[model samples]
Target: MTRPLLDQARIHPAALAQIGSYHTDLIAEVEAAVAANKVVVVGMGLNPFPAKARKILDGQGTPYKYLSYGNYFSQWRPRLALKLWSGWATFPLIFVNGTLIGGATDLQKLIASGEFVRLLG
Candidate 1:
């Protein structure tokens, strides 16, 4: 049998360090929220992916923590930096129990395949 997703999941040390509190207290708060919550969604601007992810979570009767940072015109750089480091190219970087679940498409795939449910428990 294969190992569980959570069991196989790992955050690279270099990538973890790349996060490095870059957004003052905002990123810190996100980190703290992620630590406290089983499901966490990090996004940029008023992105639709986060909403989509939330809709899925809601449909699944699961509670999730949402954290959005930066915007389109002025402050998107920070979120871009987050993407560069985290290897997620889009909004709604979903995480379950501190494991990266990626963006909206990734979330959808996991949910459709029943992996999301398995990971949750």
Candidate 2:
């Protein structure tokens, strides 16, 4: 049988510590968000993607935590590892029900297709 979508990507805490570049609190938040039933969106400022993501969650009456790095270049100063971890070069790195469902465009597709609502269930 196929694995559930919510069970797809897991945030390994020890692995994050091994990287040792990001702040402990940030890692803890990421880990916590991944383990929650709600949505989590990590992005930088001045990006439409993150805002778009928040809108989607708002429309569905879903609550999400939005994390930002202020700017794209600022992200590389300390969030390069996070970019590597999420494997996305964009602004919003979204997660839902402990799964990294991807960014705005990806989330939009899911919302449009009605997969997002189903996924949350």
Candidate 3:
């Protein structure tokens, strides 16, 4: 499952460092959460999906760490860095046991299949 990204070699040497460092702090924050928690949900305000994901976790009695960056009106740049870093296009980027399991729908499927608990173990 390879997603197409611009070849790094095609990027000018002068821009590589800048590109690599863009919103690094935000990425680092999410990384830290993912590392420390069994389940981490990276989301933004004003979005129902993240909340939906949380509700699902709650219903299942699953404890998770959530990292919300910004809403529809603010802090889009930091969220963009998260999207680029995770290769997930939407909010509520869910990580289980340090691996990205995708968003709410994906989480639901995992729960339905009883894989979510397995992942936690």
Best by lDDT: 3
Query: How does each model score on TM-score?
Result: 0.73, 0.72, 0.97
Q: How many residue pairs clash in each candidate?
A: 0, 0, 0
Instruction: State the C-alpha lDDT per candidate.
Output: 0.77, 0.74, 0.94
Q: Indicate the worst ten consecutive residues by lDDT in candidate 1.
A: 1-10
- Listing every candidate in turn, what is its Cα RMSD in Å to the true structure after a full C-alpha superposition? 7.4, 7.0, 0.9
Candidate 3 lDDT tens digits, 1-121:
5999899999998899899999999898889999999999998999999999999999989999989988999999989999989899999999999999999999999999999889999
**Once model 3 is optimally superposed onto the true structure by TM-score, how far is the C-alpha of residue 97 displaced, in angstroms?**
0.3
Error of 2 at 8 (Å): 24
RMSD value for candidate 1:
7.4
Q: Quote the lDDT for 26 in model 2.
A: 67
Instruction: Rate residue 58 of model 1 by lDDT.
Output: 88
Q: Write the per-residue lDDT of candidate 1 for residues 40-111, one digit (tens) a residue.
A: 988766677788888888888899988878666666877766665566677878889888888888988998
Which candidate order results from sorting by TM-score in descending order? 3, 1, 2
Which of 2 and 3 is the better model by TM-score? Answer: 3
